[model samples]
Target: MLKDVFVVAATSFVALPALAQTCAFTMECYETEACQDTSFALTAELDDSKLVTDFGDLTVVGVKRDAPLITVFATGEGAEYLLSRNGDTARFTAHSNDGPTAITYLGTCEGEF
Candidate 1:
């Protein structure tokens, strides 16, 4: 019985982080130079260690689990993306690898799984 209790406690502890880090949304991206907005579906998986996305992957630099904001950086491409979620609304910003081409995306959270 003690071992079963430990197993259940450990499983819940390990699963909490994964559950907090998974989210999905659909976003309208506004590109600066293009002068147009495009829509895309994005799913983000952010663990304590790393952040993964559709366009590219980044290392989890910092995260506020309370505010549910994540700051992630690409490995060597000088790119960064910020994801912030508030209720069913989320905002995403992707910085370009070039000089000053940043894209801002406004999105609604589809669901979290």
Candidate 2:
């Protein structure tokens, strides 16, 4: 009976789904040198739980732009990011499993080029 109970508990725990949260965010990339003017936009659906849950300092990994380096802030999942660009429009990848996908919390901006 104890073994059976343990097995049932384990099964139930495995059946539990991962926590999910969602939000909409956008980041615009600027020029490589001056970075004064706007160049492109990157938008993503972020999972709130996985991101910087605490309002602490967001750790920025790296940034790239225009097939090279650009000044921009990104905060979201580490999963495969599907990027779609048209002229100057930006869009994010849509997941079929869940909505409001997890996101890494990118910080805000207050500086000029």
Candidate 3:
């Protein structure tokens, strides 16, 4: 009986739910500056608290994630941009800052995570 109990406990421990799960998303950003008129697209893959971006309109150089937020760093010529997003949803939103200029992106991301 003790052996059976130990086996059951071991199985139960293995069946425990994960504390955290990774999220992979593909997002397209259309309309800039938090609902303005300039179309763009940017996608990112998030794992725990890290993100890697696939460049579309902006060349992603580096990425960092803090909880539900993600920031992707990029640059081109004399322009530098800081891009960021929050959460994982189809209705995706992102923000970018280049010196005195700031831009926002809105679109759909491919994920149910």
Candidate 4:
């Protein structure tokens, strides 16, 4: 009985880290110009509190657990972005620092890490 209990405890401990999973996403947005479109990729490391992408590294600041939304900020660029996940699809929106230059991203989940 003691051996079984220990095994269960060990399994739970190992699985605990997997509960905080990382997600990979591919995002695309259209530029201000009518014919321009930009594509990018990003990864959300929930356990590490980071959003990694080609643009720059963003620090995850807030999360809405009930709705599965993440708010991240980049200090160097003074940018704030919201990543909202709905099942297999996700929407990302970046707010402009100055004015009128915000971008919207539509993407799908690549997988979890």
Candidate 5:
């Protein structure tokens, strides 16, 4: 019985890598919310749960699954953001330094997580 359970568990873990995916998000900054002015294309590592942008690499702090929408929360040195995706379309928002300024990111995803 123990051997059978181990085999099943090992088989399940083997399939995890196949579920890992990477997504590219576009930064859409508002007039007042200037995220370095030119930093775009934030890469999301779905399997690794990491987001890479002009703020550098940020590890996902939490995740929320709301049916069609899946959201990941991440924080940087002075900024925090959430990336939420429904199918191919995704929306992202970030606030830094605890100020009122916030930046929004919008784009389409290519793979599944």
Candidate 6:
């Protein structure tokens, strides 16, 4: 019984990390200040959207304090920059090229059928 219990506990420990898994994404970006020819992949999620982008020895517009980090992006004209959060959505905008890009936190989403 003790051996079976230990096996179950080990399985739970192994499976918990998988259950808390997050999604990954890739994006290509290029601007005057920075340019990235190669695409990089980073983890992301629909909720509390976290992304990681890193171009090794590639031309890019900015610097990171850490080796990898996530940034926001937009599509089309007037399209709000989107971030995910457990079924909630947040939008951000590029305030300037000087900083890590300004992200205006849009509140959580509500109302559902």
lDDT of 2 by residue, 46-79 (tens): 2221223223323334333563213333343443
lDDT of 4 by residue, 83-110 (tens): 7766667777777777646677776654
Root-mean-square deviation per candidate: 4.5, 15.2, 7.8, 3.9, 4.2, 12.5
lDDT of 6 by residue, 40-68 (tens): 23233223233332422111232222222
Kindly indicate the candidate among 1 and 2 with the higher TM-score: 1
Q: Taking the tens digit of each residue's C-alpha lDDT, what string does model 3 give over 11-69?
A: 88675432322233343443442344444444443333222334434455776668676
Q: Which 10 consecutive positions of candidate 3 have the poorest summed lDDT?
A: 17-26
Which one wins on lDDT?
Answer: 5
Model 3 segments more than 4 A misplaced? 1-35, 44-58, 89-99, 111-113
Give the TM-score ranking, best first. 5, 4, 1, 3, 6, 2
Candidate 6 residues lying further than 4 Å off, grouped into runs, are: 15-88, 99-113
lDDT of 4: 0.63
| Pairs with backbone N, CA or C atoms under 3 Å apart (clashes), candidate 1 | none
| TM-score of every candidate relative to the true structure | 0.58, 0.21, 0.38, 0.65, 0.69, 0.28
How much does candidate 2 score in TM-score?
A: 0.21
Q: In model 4, state the lDDT of residue 79.
A: 64
Highest-TM-score candidate: 5
User: After aligning candidate 5 to the native by TM-score, how far in Å is the CA of 103 from where it should be?
Assistant: 0.6
lDDT of 5 by residue, 1-113 (tens): 99999999888866545443345555576646554433356677756778866658988888888889988899878888888889888777887776666777677666666
Candidate 1 versus truth, CA RMSD in Å, comes to 4.5
| Local distance difference test, candidate 2 | 0.33
- C-alpha lDDT values of all predictions: 0.59, 0.33, 0.46, 0.63, 0.73, 0.34
Better of 4 and 6 by lDDT: 4
